[model samples]
Target chain A: MTANARPILETERYRLRILTPADATPRYLGWLNDPQVTRYLESRHRPNGLDDIRAYITSHDGHAGFLLGIFTKTGEHVGNYSMRIDLPNAVGTLGVMIGDRDHWGRDVVLETRAAMLHYAFETLRLHKVCGACLSTNLPAIYNYRRQGWAHEGIRREQAIGDGGSRVDVVMFGMLARDWRQRREMEQEK
Target chain B: MSAAKEVLAQAFDVSITEVPDDAGMETFTPWDSLGHLKVIAAIEEKIGRDLNTEEVLAVIDLASIEKLIAGVHRV
Candidate 1:
């Protein structure tokens, strides 16, 4: 809960901890190495080698926000979530990667996203937060919509993916004011 | 229509018709585990209020939702 040490963000069911080099192998490698896992990620094709992972860790060593390792109360590593600070824009881009298939369809991601959003808005003082996903990722798109992000637009065939194919990304965003409104409505209900 | 019905409909993306006449714990589909939090979020946004966990769970029907809104006004 302290600012310096990465604190555990407790929800009704799960806790999130900041990632470290020690989390490199089990948490990172487990997902980074899986083609199915990284299919929608920009770095999908990056060779999932130890050297590559080490470089990736170093690259994100002092990032403005964090790439956190999410866990259950029983101390099971479930997946990853990120809060990327865009200082120039005075906003943040939130991301989540849930590796455990068992946890899908349970709304854990939605709950976790909400918890992180609360922290981002209340603790970090962010002006806005946004998310993006492959146009084909229906679950992600649906979840984001349910979480109150607006569909900004789509990029047409902008990036090449693992198979030399192009993928269009659907973008979504929410301002602090809108988030506040949504939170207020939830409270009143 | 009660204020609670309006708020709940807007939040769950459902029409007023979707809510049953005897809607309670058994009637609302979106009133499930996850949707409950979202319903809470929508209510907070519409009325600019905060709800404690006890208050949120105490909500079982439209009347409770209206009561919560009324209590906020009283404060």
Candidate 2:
């Protein structure tokens, strides 16, 4: 979708919009460079800079996949959430980061993921959505579970974490049917 | 504990009485990287201003956060 045509997803506190090259500011780069922020993330494995951010925006700007910037209702650029689509499989791999340290522990990811999942199953008519994260990342694992993603399996020793420690990658997936059922169950509460 | 310290205690899910005056990531088991962010966000809400990068980094402990909040109110 074109930038202007991109759909904006909203939650009670956050607005998810398309990320553009204009967001590659020093502050954005700062999050990439902060080891504390990027730890347990694949981005930490690469050398990230403005060029990388710009290149990312250019490549994914109008594709089936969406790279969204997560902003507060007041428009603070706090972080990003992305979904990469595999059309043949009707599945999307999800990723997210709350770069603004001040926005952590606020359930922003949960809200954004819910909005993205709604678009995935309801709007795009996708069959499944999956995510993978370092197993050591307890908060992410908890959030995904709370959102009804089933624990698929572990990719044993799949990645290196801080200080070169090998870590298992946990995989989680949710089918559209399961999502619908979970929503119904929640509403009945 | 001060109000900012109380906020930190809530973010970390500890009792206000249990939160020490110098509670921080290094000293408190619950104040991990994510917990640190939560504390900062809560402090910002309490103080009514967004903290700069430098101030955020400087606020490594309860005393430091109180100091930063004090500085913001002083201006």
Candidate 3:
């Protein structure tokens, strides 16, 4: 999709940009409000309104964290990639949300991770990027492995699912070295 | 019926031609969570046994599946 002048990262089919306060639209608020959309996200626990969205967007200035909007070539905001950086440790924890139902199962999250991981390791010079998902979120678990993150460990019975069942959190990590090797492997292929 | 790629292609409802040389769960569109479960069941049906959670998760790629099938046949 055609991107704005400043994109944090660009993939084959996505433009990742830091979201602005004005980018907080009613549709975005609806995604957070929709249980089907936010079921796996902690944000699902609370209802998010325009003001909250705007405030959160502004809070991230690309230094401490980024509220990046993933846009299609046609300029539709289908999802977001959120990265929270720990300056002292040089680690970033990332999460993805494909708000648009139409984009589900389309491998958007996979591409988003590839682009953002490059940014985190190369641009930001972060030492590592990590993410965790609920054990029951099988798609996410497979993505973490497919994306080349080491399955660091699991926090047993860490969280409760919507069904009121305890679910473990699977931790994943990728160091700068791992990212380099992955890129090298891609080049070799 | 005994080929790893064939089993995966069948489980994912795709043709063997579509699968990559270094085939893995990520490379295919239908190889998601549900597809993963189907792959496990398909493999079990071919091997004529059930797989444990560990064995199921270890089916990371086509090569791994091939190795698992070979090991089962050896036994």
Candidate 4:
């Protein structure tokens, strides 16, 4: 957590590090092009190429915020987590995609989210952290609700979904105090 | 499931043994929106307070309900 040092995070079973242009591989491109993997993500709106992925990764060089690669202990890259901050508001917006179908339903989301929340609140010391998902994504909606994130509101028919159907965007928010309270409660358990 | 079996079983109107380990929105057939709220209400009654968003979300299924009302199943 030292200043000016590269941030590399490790949980019990996963290691998360910033993704660079070199990290963009055909497999990563495959994920962006996979409808099943990107179903609930905004990325599904358009196709992506290797150059696009590289540029996206290059844009977040950790100057302010960066894209994190979610990796297994065995060095397999399964997904991506992006963090963007509004310094004036001291708020962060997180976007995630578990591209690897093999890792679905395996608690990777829960584990990685805990790590990112800690980094967001404890390390970054941000005032708030939030994420949004399409309303049609039942599993994500269920996760956000179960995680106790405040349902800020929903943007009705925010975007188009598969088959040209419109979908609402649901937002969830968590404040610094709320994070502390949740942690304290976890300790009491 | 010992802690909240009666509550879940009663809400779903089934025997306690009928509740499976993976009973959730996706797995449990009866766990629709109404059933979810029912479980939430029962958990609230057991805890003696209304569930906050976080607590409500934690009670996704039978095991979560047991965890929410911990110590009831341990004994």
Best by DockQ: 3
Report the C-alpha lDDT of model 2 over A1-189, residue by residue, as the tens digit: 122338699999989988889989899999999987899778897899899999977667445678889988999899998888887888888898889889877778877889989888888788999998886675676466557688787787889887887877888899999999999988998
Model 1: CA > 4 A from native: A1-5, A61-63, A161-164, B1-75
Whole-model alpha-carbon lDDT for candidate 3: 0.80
For residue B59, model 3's alpha carbon misses the true position, in angstroms, by 3.6
- On the 0 to 100 scale, the lDDT of residue B64 in model 4 is 72
Q: What would the per-residue lDDT of candidate 4 be over residues B15-75, giving only the tens digit for each residue?
A: 9898776776557777654356567667777778765434544556667777778843321
Deviation of model 1 at B61, angstroms = 22
Model 4 clash pairs?
A: A148-B54
Please give, as one word, the docking class of candidate 3: acceptable
The predicted structure with the larger lDDT, 2 or 3, is: 3
Residues A51-155, candidate 3: write the lDDT tens digits.
999988887766777889999988899989888888899999998888998887777888888988888887788899999987666667777877788888778
- Between which residue pairs do clashes occur in model 2? none
Q: What TM-score is obtained for chain B in each of the predicted models? A: 0.75, 0.81, 0.81, 0.77
Q: Highest lDDT, which number?
A: 3
The runs of at least 3 residues in candidate 3 whose Cα sits more than 4 Å from the true structure, single-residue gaps closed, are A1-7, B1-10, B14-23, B26-29, B32-34, B37-57, B62-75
- CA lDDT of A76 in candidate 2? 89
Superposed by TM-score, candidate 3 places the C-alpha of residue A117 at a distance from the truth, in angstroms, of: 1.1
Ranking by TM-score: 3, 4, 2, 1
Can you write out model 1's per-residue Cα lDDT over A82-163, one digit (the tens) per residue?
7778766768888888887677667787789887887777777678888888754546765776677877877767677557
Question: Which portion of correct inter-chain contacts appears in model 1?
Answer: 0.00
Q: What is candidate 3's TM-score for chain A?
A: 0.93
